[model samples]
Target: MSVSPSSPVRNPWIVLACAATIVTIAMGIRQSSGLFLRPIELELGVGREAFGLAIAVQNLILGLAQPFIGALADRHGAGRVAAAGAAVYALGLILASQSATALGLNLTLGFLVGLAMTGVTFVVVIGAAARAVPPEKRGLAAGIVTAGGSFGQFLLVPLAQGLIGSFGWRETFLIFAALAAAIAVLAIGIAGRPRQQAGISTQSFGEALREASGHSGFWLLNGGFFVCGFHVAFIGTHLPAFLADRGLDPAVGARALALIGLFNIIGSYLFGLSADRFRKKYVLSGIYFGRAAIMALFLSVPFSPLSATLFAAAMGFLWLGTVPLTSGLVGQIFGVRYLSTLFGIVFLFHQLGAFFGAWAAGLAYEATGSYDLAWTASIALALMAGLLNWPIRDAPVARLSMEGAR
Candidate 1:
């Protein structure tokens, strides 16, 4: 039901806060995974590739499942899906702790974890936030939600590192499991029946895909987001290792990643506000271009504590900046009716890129004994993404809107 314009329920800040909290807690757990890698490898006697493959699988599976979860949220209620996801996510972590073999780990942490992630992450969180806020505020809401993930990275990574230092990695997983379980409570605040107006315009899952697939702008948006996945997943998963390789202490890399998370809060909020005031597509295009420029500068300059810190600051600003614009565009083109499902499909592409991004960095480093190639490819992708987004037509697609009523 539509709240009358004057109702307090329509207050944008209230909606933004709810979205931000959900994203923050969910993302915080996901960010802590990097802290587990070395410990799991040491305990299990698995090669880096084995662990890497599991993470890649997780990204791939999460991407694939996102659309389904998003569709369910759009069709039913985000609250129910999120609550279910929290349960599964907690269970997945608990299962991971029990897995004694490589295959078990793969299934538990890899596939099941990915499945759990879909319910809690951007797909569901952003969908609810979108419907809660007005059209003009959607971009800002998306940014706030995305920033919550960054906030998670900032707040949880250090906590994970401390946990690893104090307790064993296996126990860490157990603790994380408990935290995931707690999200079920938060889900209550986010859950409810979909507003009647939002449901009435939702298309079937297949129809939303067909509509998105047919749009050139959607393709460009997808392709650009692919680069975003590449940049973020690569750096998030492997930057610590790179810092260690450059002779900085391991703690330095961890701190740097934490800094990225902390600083990204500012970046995400600023980018979101900019999207609200300006044309979203252009804002996204500029952010991509900025990434390309920053990556180039970072690679050209000699690596050092100062340079690395500066690079992290610059990149953090661009990190997840696409979220506000990309998600906002989905709502703009399709309306909020089927947004979760449609955006989840788009996120699948993003995850596909993330799988490669995270997986490829490991492979590239092992093969070349350096991460230069991966870094270069990231820069090129950013440039290509900037170009591709430049031409996207952001006006509503009327045919799809009509078809959504069926």
Candidate 2:
């Protein structure tokens, strides 16, 4: 297979670096959103479910917008889309800080931020990075970009915590808004549309969707990622509160979330390497099973700050390892022509899982004053996801195989 070099304008290293930076700033601030739950509930006189609902709505909007936005990225390019998204993301954060009611937050944070994220987050950025590299390099390239998000989580979560400590959650958000705006400048570095190298104009987005829909493996991939979304959203949003419910310092949860970010850098990179060397499907299956095992251990073990920290480290290593592998698999099997659009559909399923995960956790805590039921659901889903990924027919689609032959 003779893969062509990227366009002269799209420097692989530069695009990957920009993609990483974008993911860092975007995901870092977004993931820390969970940290504001307690303070927001107190100041706004809203319940946990209210705040959770807002975040839940954000995830839903993100999922709903991905395919259309992804198709646009596929056709046009990510530069303008990402820049506009950065602008909106910054504006949303600024407005969210000024919000006086939960409904106001729902509009600013939930709706606006959710829409902006589709532009700056993995789907758009990963598509750009994938286009900048050859097929063999896609897995590790995706990993490198995903690791950037972990780095942000490591650094920014703690930074947000400190800022909230000294100033307030609203002030912290204003600061993050400034950080969000920076992505627009970086978007220039990643500019370039992906041309179809495999076969020119052989497939349309509708045909791509139709082909994938007929493939059992694609649906299985979606089912597995659904569990991944559930685990990530549930744990990331609720872990700090769960730890606090057991009589620990609020800072402990913050540190734990940071630790997850720190270790995930190594994990995502390693898993990226693993995907290039091993079967992505088996590796994905292992990751899901490992998550289930670790969460089960967390539940059975006695509660302590040390235990929470360890759990964070363990889960963090597994945190986003799925992103590179999942996206990589999509490219490996389907080809990268409409990689962003196809993966966007997969990500929609992921966000659906996230929506349910975030909302259900709040409902569980409100009704039972504990997250035990949510945790159980996460564990069961993880196990189920493990099985779902195991049987995927990990091979290139017929068209890709024919293209490779050419």
Candidate 3:
């Protein structure tokens, strides 16, 4: 028997590969931004609070733009939007390299890069990949695309460190700008065909938004995801400084982040598989609970290089594991027609949490000369997030159910 010319099985892998690679470039560069914080602040003679505020703005803009970008992807094409994002992102990097003040950095890195990321990152790349694959394979496909980000983190963090060390932060940004521009060329592979609006009238965008707004489970998912953003952004942005405060070598922080990235590859894939086989809400709850437990253990133990390494390994495994389950749940409850937009709405909450996490950590440390308060808040939020996911009803929405009945 020959396969049909239009079968997803025939070309799904190719699309997945392209989506994953595009995600790798976008996420790797974003993740490595933390490594430049110290160097940039020192060179520019700015306080940590100012730099952290800039990153906070970036996260805020990324979240705010997600819904619009996702809508654009749903209407136009993921490839075009992502390619355009890459061009803007590269421009932001180039301009950021020349920025001498916090305000300039806020415009270039905070607003432009953040806005560009909405197109190049999950909402566009993962959403396109999820649409390209069969329903059963979406969990795995989302996982693979997300893992690409982890792989980038593992690969690029060290490379970024080397670049910053060898040349300078300005020169490093230039090199990264070139890489970002290259992503525009690579994005063509995952563009897929244009949207076809024939047989799929389950819900209009307004209807879908209204339905999601009325659903308690949807709010629960958003709440849980908010905690995820807070934890991830805070740690990713501040871990290096935290480690330095603990008297560990700078290399230890880099190594720790690398370990997290490496283990995240395993965790993302496994959780993706788990979501396919188990209750997605339960899986998400477990991830959040596990994060809380791991953080508690790390805090209880004495601070040392060995302890820090162990913390990194444990935290890395749980780092991005929430993404697959959260996204899968969104697609599961609502159909894929509006997946990008719905998920983008949820992501806005996540970014809001991230803004506070990144900015507040800096403020707390600056005021108190310690990260102890941030650590406590993360643990509390993790526990709260776990509780939030526990009660989320993961059943299909009424619209999908009605469509299925018909």
Name the top lDDT candidate.
Answer: 2
Residue 368 CA error for candidate 3 (Å)? 0.4
State how far residue 211 of model 1 sits from its true place (Å): 2.6
| Model 3 alpha-carbon drift over 4 Å, by segment | 1-10, 193-202
Candidate 3 per-residue C-alpha lDDT over 1-406 given as tens digits, one digit per residue, 9 for 90 to 100: 2222222234667778888888888888988878888898789998778888888999999999999999888877788898999999999999999999999999998999999899999877778877776677788888998899899899988889899999999999999999999888878777754353345454677988988889999999899989998998899889988998889888888888888888899998998888788999988989989999999999998888999889988999988889888999999988677788989999999999999988999999899999999999999999999999998888998777766665
Compute the lDDT of residue 158 as modeled in candidate 3. 88
lDDT of 1 at 184: 84
Candidate 2 residue-wise lDDT, 259-342, digit = tens: 999999999999988878999999999999999999999999899999999999999999999999999989888888788899
**Order of models, best lDDT first:** 2, 3, 1
User: Each model's TM-score?
Assistant: 0.92, 0.97, 0.96
Question: After TM-score superposition, what is the CA distance of residue 97 in candidate 3 from its true location, in Å?
Answer: 0.5
Q: How much lDDT does each candidate structure score?
A: 0.81, 0.90, 0.86
**Error of model 3, residue 357, in angstroms:** 1.0
Global Cα lDDT for candidate 2: 0.90
In order of TM-score, best first, we have 2, 3, 1
